[model samples]
Target chain A: MNITKVLDAKGLACPMPIVKTKKAINEIESGQILEIHATDKGAKNDLTAWANSGGHELIKHEEENDVFKFWIKKG
Target chain B: MTDKKKTTIVLFSGDYDKAMAAYIIANGAAAYDHEVTIFHTFWGLNALRKDENIPVEKGFMEKMFAKMMPRGADKMGLSNMNFAGFGPKMIKDVMKKHNAIPLPQLIEMAQEQDVKLVACTMTMDLLGLKQEELIDNIEYAGVAAYLADAEDGNVNLFI
Candidate 1:
């Protein structure tokens, strides 16, 4: 999948990662994909809820070496 | 009619942690494209005060209240484990270490996101707080305005 922007939110705590993701998602065009890398465990659930509420699609997500990565397509 | 979701928060506490929680939720809701409003009342008004003292004429009681209350969000104490005002410093340290955005910046972020910051006019009068004592770019209103926004709100909270 094509990624329009990459957001590095590692090391940030609750709300920061989500805040940054929201801002990052706005910068990209609708229907484009935004990739986010975060270390916060809460980001997984929070990002999923955020994407769902914002009408975005979380197309893919995976955890590797304690890092959580997500690809969300703006809706 | 617009279909945008709305989140209205009534901030009634003066504690640092409580204010931070309110702002965090406000900023987060705003990020989710929800129309957000934080109504500052009573002790919560301290979060909107200016750090520097402004030379505004006031009565004796007003002056006393002003002297006792915190001047700004940064000066407010924590709701728990305050330890005679040392808790805020410890929390600040932890927040810095975790790279979390501080309360002031969170407030600024809310402003940037166009979240409506409203100061309760009735509370201001009761507390002897003048408009000059608070920060700029915030709306002044009573409970009526708050209800108008909250009646159609998707989420309403009192913190």
Candidate 2:
């Protein structure tokens, strides 16, 4: 079973959150899930674009308490 | 498989607008899955500084003119373009308000995306800049370094 890891990127700006998330996802095996929490409005688009471009799958994304959440699966 | 494309941007303009334009292009390229690098030399280094505290113009005339124009980095006033008098200042103010990435953050992102950053040793030597003067995490290299990266890619832009 693959573990779901959480990445908190709140209060972080563009590129930081994305950069960290990319690093985290890189360490995960295929089908493993990494959840990213961020505040930048650009992250939704940025992460989605990154995932698609890099062959990762975006499983879920949401916003709560002004934080944007994304669940991405490593390819 | 389609060959992954990359780009190299040589930033020579010290004007705020030009720097901002380079950032926009860099960001776009990154979003599109292209590896991007930005080389700051001469005046271009000012835009990357973290201590920049220039104010965002709020006066009526400045506001009016800003609204009627491209505003910010998009309006850099290169000499050939005279009507673009307020380009530099406008770019600075917009960058300030938008919290545009500081040089440090920009370097961090470029590294994260595997974008190579090369500080022009020739220019640095000419400007009397020491390695300590630059932000941490930047690779100090000469034109040969930039050429190495540029040669491997198809996109080469001199901003």
Candidate 3:
């Protein structure tokens, strides 16, 4: 995926990652991808629900070395 | 969402942890494009207070009431394991370590996100709190107002 920007939400807890991700997503144009690297375990569920509720597209996501990476396309 | 949704939270607890949870939920709902309203009543009104009391003339009983209660989110106590009032501090430190925004910041974020913050006028009068003592930018209304808001809300929570 071609990400327009990357947000480092690592070490942040629930809501903060989502908060930051939401803010970062606004800076990109429609269809542009925003990549978020977060460590909060709850980020996965939160981001999934957030993307769905806001009509954003979760292009891809993966987990490695205890960090969760999410690629969200602005809708 | 295909249609707009609303989340209404009745904040009735003064506990720090409970207030945090309420704000977290409110912020999350707002982030997801949900219209959110937080009705602060009774102890929950403490979350809206200023950190320092604004000097105001009042009767002795009212003064005592104002002085005894927690001033703001930072001064609020934990519901349990207070440990002589140290539990809140410990939890705050832990929250800092985890990089979680505190209740005050969450409240600010809630405001920035346009979450409706309505103070219960009845409770405010009962608690002897003045409008000037709370943080800026909030609505003051009675139960009927909150009910009006909650009536059409898709999510209603009591915390």
Candidate 4:
């Protein structure tokens, strides 16, 4: 899938990745996929809850080495 | 779904880590479209104090109180391992190394997200903190106001 924006929240701690992702997702158009690159270990669960609560769809997520990547489609 | 989701926190600790935790939760709740309210009382009010000495008229006791208390997040001490105010710096350095947003920035983000920042009126009086001493963009209310906000809140936390 073609991603509209790639938000780098790597090297950040708990809540920072989600916070930055939330801000970055708003800069894109609806239906666009926002890819998040985060290093925080808890981003996996935090982003899941964040995407769900914000009414956004978590299209897919995967871990590449030490980094966790997520693609969210804004609702 | 029709009613607004509420997240209320009663912040009573002046510790840096505790304040950070409160801001983290507030920012997260606000991000998810929740109406967040942070009722800062007692030592927690220290997190909102201005660093600079504002020109405000006060009596001797008030002036003494103002000077005695730590002003702002940068000046606050940790709850443990203080070692005469060195612990905060160590933790702050760790936070910086991990590329985390500091407490002050978190507070700014919370405010920008429309989280209700409130100061306890009774605490301000007890601490001798004047209205002019706190940061901008905050509400001053007593316990009743906090109770009203927390009564129906989905997440009510005390830290």
Provide fnat values for all models in the order shown: 0.78, 0.11, 0.81, 0.70
Candidate 2 whole-model C-alpha lDDT, 0 to 1: 0.66
Judging by DockQ against the true structure, name the best candidate. 3
Model 1's alpha-carbon lDDT is 0.94
Quote fnat for model 4. 0.70
**Candidate ordering by lDDT (highest first):** 1, 3, 4, 2
Candidate 2 residue lDDT tens string, B1-159: 347777889988865445545765676566556777778776555434334223453566534533443222333354333354754455445556755564334545555666656677777555444455455566777777777768876678998
> What number of clashing residue pairs does each candidate have, in the order they appear?
0, 3, 0, 0
The TM-score-based order of candidates, best leading, equals 1, 3, 4, 2
**Per-residue error (Å), model 4, residue B72:** 1.2
> Over the stretch B1-159, how does candidate 1's per-residue lDDT look in tens digits?
688999999999999999999999999899888999999999999999999999998999999999999999999999899999999999999899988889998889899999999999998998999999999999999989999999999999999
Compute each candidate's TM-score over C-alphas. 0.97, 0.58, 0.95, 0.93
- lDDT value for model 4: 0.90
Q: Which one wins by DockQ: 1 or 2?
A: 1
Candidate structures ordered by DockQ, highest first: 3, 1, 4, 2
Worst 10 residues of 1 chain B by lDDT: B98-107
Local accuracy of candidate 3 as per-residue lDDT tens digits, A1-75: 577999999998888898888889878999999999999999898899889888998888999999999999999
Give residue B50's error in model 3 in angstroms: 0.7
In candidate 1, how many Å is residue B6 off?
0.4
